[model samples]
Target: VMGLIFAKLWSLFCNQEHKVIIVGLDNAGKTTILYQFLMNEVVHTSPTIGSNVEEIVVKNTHFLMWDIGGQESLRSSWNTYYSNTEFIILVVDSIDRERLAITKEELYRMLAHEDLRKAAVLIFANKQDMKGCMTAAEISKYLTLSSIKDHPWHIQSCCALTGEGLCQGLEWMTSRIGVR
Candidate 1:
């Protein structure tokens, strides 16, 4: 159809495509955030066993987002997709104070991979709606983000359940990608 042809042409002309991966420990709300971005509504999600991928368009830019399972057992598979990724969205359960150290360890290990050296990282300090949740600054400090000299990094507070701050995070990411 003519409409389909125009759509493809528009994509070819003005669409900027980027690959991004979402990662975090199990129960960190990665899937919830993805659904929020896609549907603009809260979605109930189960633990991801492997991965779920979706394409999103924001500000006329196209993004291929991969939501990978974050269980300890699936961590090893993360590196497999790092090579082509332009950005990494690391989710954290801001109220899980007890697991901050574990999250830090896993995050550092992921950053150390050679393929991720140039990828921009956006850490989502999720669950800000909960009581006693850590602020973005606190999470950044605990994650030792200052030491991440290899890539451009940022931390944003978000509550996936309520869809607060999700668009701002994506806007930051698109800016980092050099797309207007």
Candidate 2:
């Protein structure tokens, strides 16, 4: 019995890997967050027309994350990447107040989709360092996170450019991975 527990832990810590998809509206900083996890440094980025894939290890769990493009034209392709995804990282521009409604709409749409039904959600209220930016609580309210009952969800305030609050968010992800 003790051997079985050891084997389980070994498999989980050494071999287990999760699929995560980073998505959001165009210019919401998804790529920046992805790079922050990988290199721990901000990368100069332009609008993503396709997707970026990378492996990231946090708290001993391996996560193969895909940072997908968020332009209106590319949003339709998001579903193709949802099949094996265990986590959906939604990066929102905290200062982009005018687009909050659109972001909320996209979030609910993904949550309702059959492919993503089982995935946990992490909403990053990014750009927190800027003045007049929405707080994490405010973004949660705007996105109606309380209305979501089917999946585990969390909202974290972060400054992707500066790589702040990013670790705490990932720590939450790694913690969730062990619960089930």
Query: Which residue pairs of candidate 1 clash?
Result: none
TM-score, each model?
Answer: 0.90, 0.93
Index of the highest-lDDT prediction: 2
Q: How does each model score on lDDT? A: 0.90, 0.93
Candidate 2: RMSD over Cα atoms? 2.0
Worst 10 residues of 2 by lDDT: 171-180
Q: Which digits, one per residue and each the tens of the lDDT, describe model 1 over residues 84-136?
A: 78999999999999989989988888888888877899999999999999999
- Runs of candidate 2 with Cα error greater than 4 angstroms are 1-9
Who wins the TM-score comparison?
A: 2
True-structure RMSD, every candidate: 3.5, 2.0
Candidate 1 residues lying further than 4 Å off, grouped into runs, are: 1-13
Give me the displacement of residue 111 in model 1, in angstroms.
Answer: 1.4
